[model samples]
Target: MANTSVQTEPGTRRPGVLQAVLLLAGSCMPVLGSVLLTPILPQLSAEFGGAPGGEILVPMVVAIPALMIALFAPFAGQIVDRLGRKKLLIIAMFAYTLVGIAPAFLDTLPAILATRVGVGITEAAIMTVCTTLIVDYWHEPERRAKYLGLQTIVTTLAATAFIAIGGAAGAAGWRTPFWIYLAAAIIAVPMIFLLWEPNKADPTDSHARAPKVPIPWRRIAMPLIVGLFGGFTFYVLVIEASYLLVDAGVAPTDTPTIGGIAALASLATAAGGFTFTRIAKVGVNRILPVAFALQAVGMLIIWFVGGVPGVAVGAIVGGAGSGLLLPSMLTWAVGSTRFEERGRVTGLWTAAFFFGQFLTPIIMGAITAAVGSLPVAVGVVGIACAVAAILLGFGLRKSNMAPAEEVTATV
Candidate 1:
């Protein structure tokens, strides 16, 4: 059901290495705001303490973007469908750079948080468009899988670098990391001349028209449901690992130690992402159980052992599984969808995953409160994930008619 009719050769003969890299670079931009300011939360908290709810609001500057993506990505997806992917992407990147840098000059914490929301809105457009274009640019299943995997790998790696950069920039001043937003301008330049709309109506030919397709609600239902949990599992370690480290006796101010742990986890995630294409051969049904099991085991290790080494080991194991989770979800959501619907579907996929991410802390907090232990709460979520994986494997096995049906039918 992959859309094979579109003329992808907009300006070039076909998508080349440069085009693939450009799209991957776009994917990386969405995650930049996630951890780019983590190292400086303390500084922000101190500077804004006089403001009402500053303790709570100051830290949100980093977290609000993902929440915004969760809330607004679906709308962005609708825009991508009605307008065009290239236009939205170009605008989002430019807007991201502007809003991202707004914090550097703004004096109030609320004002900066407002800019962060703008950052998220633009990122919602960017991530959805980037992912949609990946499917559009490549119709072949193997190539699609390869690019998706590469996209995840590149983004995870960039996140690690951004964390370090954030730390270095944070040392100069709380707002210094905001300067990195300017890099988007450099990326936008290449996009202007190189990025092309694949499913767009031709400007030169009045007769040329793209066919419209209805959204396949039934086809995407399972993938969205799975993606929600997949996102939660993907982010559990990143959001809570620092606190786990502190619980293990590392000083709260030991940013280096905590950052190092995060970097190591991201490396594990990159390793997992690199394996996506190879693991894909087994089918997504078989893959999820193992991925979730790895996550379960990693969480259990951190829960029982409770230390830096334990947390690191858990992160490595969990990170590997998380690495494959996203590409698998993307493949499932779009494997049976047409090119025309890819943008809207991709937006839903982005929303599902990010909403899961936004919900993780609140859900995990509830579990922790109920159990009165953070490690145990993480462990409980891990157990739930493992159970879900097992049930999904069995259900998919029965529902999938053939090997090829695995990705489209039940995955």
Candidate 2:
């Protein structure tokens, strides 16, 4: 309820490191929903073995939130634009904690899946608002790019942690991992005191009274489409690398080696994120293609190269591209929008990304089935990404996805 302006206007204080760190922490919430329960799906299936639709509903417990995020993020964006960012984020944070842990006590699969819907809806708001706020609080391009890159790095790291912790905690019982939802409430504590709304203008400000500018939907179409590809490629390694390793002859029980390769891939991704902060000045026009090119190269290696060495190499290289992919596409999508329309633009980008994630497995499955090989399916996707990289590199040369030049409000 305190003043919500984070800008360094005459009176408002500019948000610094603490705010960025909090936003990064908040960004990891969806990752928990995505990966935290991954290791416990078998247990969940067993727990509700007798329930109607248990087989399908069980996998949905992990997938439904992402679908909700994809479905509702644009609506959440509208809410952020109209209702303000901090209030929606705070309300959703507490709501997230409650519904997030609800499964611990639920008896039926349907009931638990319903709570996952709540988790998804709240996550839609949480992700939209947190991302909007990160750039809002840090308008300076270097600072903004740094945090954006860090967001990918931190969340990627968190996904690994969540999976491991989920596995470890599942040793006690499937319900125990749900307790980790407490992280949201714990993060909400500092947020209550430190996080403030960006651009909370006084009634007297002329621009504050000006009519809201509509988002340039046409201008954003290609970027969103490109983001769809980026999103699909981004999650390819994260979701499919384990199967890739197994297919390459690693034993199913060789978790440490598998985990090591996965971890190496993650570190490679974090390296890509770190690279983004330094290369961001080149603009998304250039960086976008490079990211995809890297991904394509890795996938091609998997198809043509073969063996555990090839698969491991492919994962690491593909992950590095993924690390660069998100931040570049995000900047490309929302960098031109002003404060009035930023939330909606960011929401659209978030939707495109998550929707691609939702489709990745289904699409990849079809590709694998049609071709009768996982590496070949991945190669086909990689070729598609390669074409996109070439096209974007040429087509976007004239257009720069640079952040809006002015931080001040404009009518």
C-alpha RMSD values across all candidates: 4.5, 4.6
lDDT of 1 by residue, 1-411 (tens): 222223445542356666787889989998888777776666675689779977556656766787899888888888987887898899889999999999999998889989999999999999999988777776566677778778888998998888777766776778889999987878988988877876444432221254777878877888889888888878788777766877788765566666777777888788877787667767877777777887888898888877888888988888887887777777777655666677788888888888887777677777889999888888998898789778887887876521454343211
Local accuracy by lDDT, each model: 0.78, 0.78
Give the C-alpha miss distance for residue 52 in model 1, angstroms.
4.9
Lowest summed-lDDT stretch of 10 residues in model 2? 402-411
Model 2: per-residue Cα lDDT over 1-411, one tens digit each: 123435545645666678777899999998888777755665665677568766556656776787788899999999999989998998999999999999899877888889999999999999999998877776655566667777878987877677667766777787888999989999988898998766646421223444688888887898889877787788666666666877888764454565567667777777887787777766677788899999999999989998899988988898889888887888777655667888999998888888887777778878989999988999998898899889888987876445333211111
Leading candidate by TM-score: 1
lDDT of 1: 0.78
**TM-scores of all predicted structures:** 0.89, 0.85
Model 2 clash number: 0
What is the Å distance of residue 230 in model 2 from its true position? 1.5
